[model samples]
Target: MDIKRSYKGAVEISVILLFTVMIFSCGKDTPGTIEPEKKNEKWRTTAVKDSIGNQYYVVNTLDNKLEIRVDNKEGKTIFAEVCPTIDPAEIPSEAAMVITGVATPNKYISINDATLVLKIVMDDVKIQKKYIQLLANINLDTKKFYTKKYKIEKPEDWTIVDYNNVVHWYQNTLLVREGTDYDLNRGGGFMGLGQRGTQLVCYERDFTIRYTKDIDANLASYPSGSGGQYIPINNFEDMAFRSDGLISRVQIVTSVEDEWAGKKDIVWQNDLKKSSNIPADYSVRITDYNIQGDEVIASYTIFDEKGNVKYKRTGKWALSNGFPRGYTTE
Candidate 1:
């Protein structure tokens, strides 16, 4: 009887221990590990009106920083709450620090525009210190407008040549390629209808430059090309932005015999893209040019087979794959 009772007690104790172990194993996940929280890194633009009813663009960053950029002023940032600490003694109202850039969340503080108006509002206390610091960069009357002329030297002894300018502000690189094609009938002189072919090669050169004036501090460049983003410009007015963008792509159907059609298959290396058959005699020229914010506006005249102006167009230059293809107005 004593042995029977001892066995029963041992079995009961083992059962209790096993149940406790199972319970502990099941509860292990509750406190053993933790999941981290994800952060939103998108930056957005906000617009707010100041005490005097002037509007501006203000950006609130993810890390509790505020960026203020003006159209013609130097940009300012408040990295810490105490650094841009607004003193209540100079307080005007509760709307001063409220920044309204664009409601859309994006990294750029400005609203897809060269011109931005930002207002800061926080408890109606004006973040005037930051605004005033940034404002002085624009209000200086000593600023002047300047222009740089790009001198593209025409190769003196080329048979036919074409010129194009590639302006990529984002890359800080300007590329110019001169496509020259020369045809020669050699080895048979005059009447043999000698081996004829079109020779094509594009001489590419870099023309990107930096502005040497103090005004460069007031200007801004756009981000990478994502298609359909305009580098705006109005031809009739003075430009306040970086540049006037231009891209022209015309359908050229050309049928040249012998050398050109026969040799290397006639390759085009410049901005002039052949839609169909591009003859070796077509030429394009740009006359009036203007750079506005986000768009390149210009006037171009195309010379056809007989050297007369085939057509003249005025509008925004079109782009393909971050490079200008032709003229576009829409």
Candidate 2:
């Protein structure tokens, strides 16, 4: 065994150990100091339509590349292999490549076609190239828009079978309107029985108003009636659906001149004691009744055009099926 180590040998070993320790230490490459490499984010697709009504999906991938595919009007894959070079910010970053419901009609795929991948790509990008598709079942383009809508609340109430498609609903409101008429006589001869002095006598009668959702409700045309006899709003009496769909509920609209309706005793309120006429500013709505446990009662409501509840009619509903009068103490 050596009694003492050589100074030269010790110095050489120490230098070697110092160099190893310095090399192992991560000075600038420490965990917190190093930043992460950014990933390519996806962007929503853009759509372009040609003159002949064809749609194409413009997609920008994560690696800053632009791609286009036919979204609708199949077999029109002329844009295949035409990957335009563009930044990813050209499209919506959060938007997924989608096939909107507007293209439902033009969706078509042939079984004989060998290529299952719809669009052909040419550019080599870092992002994973995936085919995305969203489709629709029914076609909405060719179907003619029908503006007629009918809301039939009860199953067997008033229905337009073949004339117009009826949409049924569970809750319905019945509107039964009654008005009063007057029979006047003048009394002068005998105990107010004979007519000489004027005496006002009155009785009530049914207004005979009808309800229909038809756009052509036989209400006289407006503006034409203005010059001829009545006010412009007085003649307009038709309603139609804004779009063709099954209507579960509807608000029947009516327009009338405030002065004319007031003077003519055309009471929208249907009150015998009080006078009610259509307001020029506010709207009048009466809910038609539907069947509720063998009972039908019309309900009415009046509100401003903004849907604020202003006035509500009494709950005195006309019962279709009830016990005979005087049977129950009201």
Candidate 3:
């Protein structure tokens, strides 16, 4: 009787093991009918938008040759241009011609309509003809003035004389001044000099000037409840065109005192004025203090040679504003 019972238990265990194996085997093969791999789908595409709201789609294969599609409003595709084959090494870092991406060992075409080429190059080193699109031009009797052109289209090369005569090339865009600033005429439009999206700025001769910190002493003697009152440096933002003719550097100076009367309670530092100074002229004059109260407000203004104000702004914070924080660990 004992042997018969043991044999029955062994058969039951064998049946359970067989059922488990069949379940796993069935899972390995999906239930649906297998389809053949597709071969005709040769190219993959990705779409990007420029600053001007134009849409560009890039179609590419594994070997890296490209076809670009530019679409306008109403969803109509306007252009389909084939990009020339290029070696990665021959491309300039700021080449507005080449799209940029994370270049890997495989060297796949990662980005198609990237607008970063020209501006990126301008940021690092100077170029010869940095063509920029004309944003606006004023043909005055005295001097021609240009404004709001894009950076990509700035000229690559230029020669200026004593901040009076100017000449520069931005890509296909050009700005020339034959006489003094008063005699120059400032209206012309061009394309291929800037990013695809932004409104074009008018072109002008590249020039430079010396700037210094303008501080007020009497305004520096103010009162405070806990910490000393503020000192504003909103006037120090200045924009300068590069030697190549693109408005490249914007220098900003801020004034904030860390301690007052040896009491060190309220810290004063205002880097907040940097962004506010963008619209004003490259030369800035900041008024350091207020006459009514110890609370200081920095004022900035752009002026003509005769000191007529062209643009002006006021700064909000001092250097004492606490350090802002946020960063990704990865």
Q: Give Cα-based local distance difference scores for all models.
A: 0.30, 0.28, 0.30
Q: How much RMSD separates candidate 3 from the native structure?
A: 21.5
Residue 8 in candidate 2 has what lDDT?
A: 70
How does each model score on TM-score?
Answer: 0.19, 0.16, 0.21
Task: Give per-residue CA lDDT, model 1, range 142-229, as digits (tens).
Answer: 2211111211122222221111111222212221112211122233332112222232221111222332111011121112122222
The residue-by-residue lDDT of candidate 3 on 1-330, one tens digit each, is: 999999999999999999999977776675554454452223433445543444554444334444444565555666554443333332343234333221011001111212211111323333323322212222212223233223332232221111111111222122222122111112221212111111112132221212222212222221111111222222221122122112211222212331222322123333322443443334445533231232233445545556676665543322223232321111
* True-structure RMSD, every candidate: 23.9, 26.0, 21.5
lDDT of 3 at 99: 33
Candidate 1 Cα deviation (angstroms), residue 155: 33
lDDT of 2: 0.28
Kindly give the stretch of ten consecutive residues in candidate 1 with the minimal lDDT sum: 131-140
**lDDT digits (tens) for residues 1-330 of candidate 2:** 243557777888999999888866764578776676553335534554533555645445666565444434574444332233222333334444232222111111111111111121112222212222211111123321111112222222221111011111111111211111111112222111211111111111111223422222222111110111111111221111111111111122222432334322221222311222535555544443232343323345656668786765523322322222221111
Model 1 scores a C-alpha lDDT of 0.30
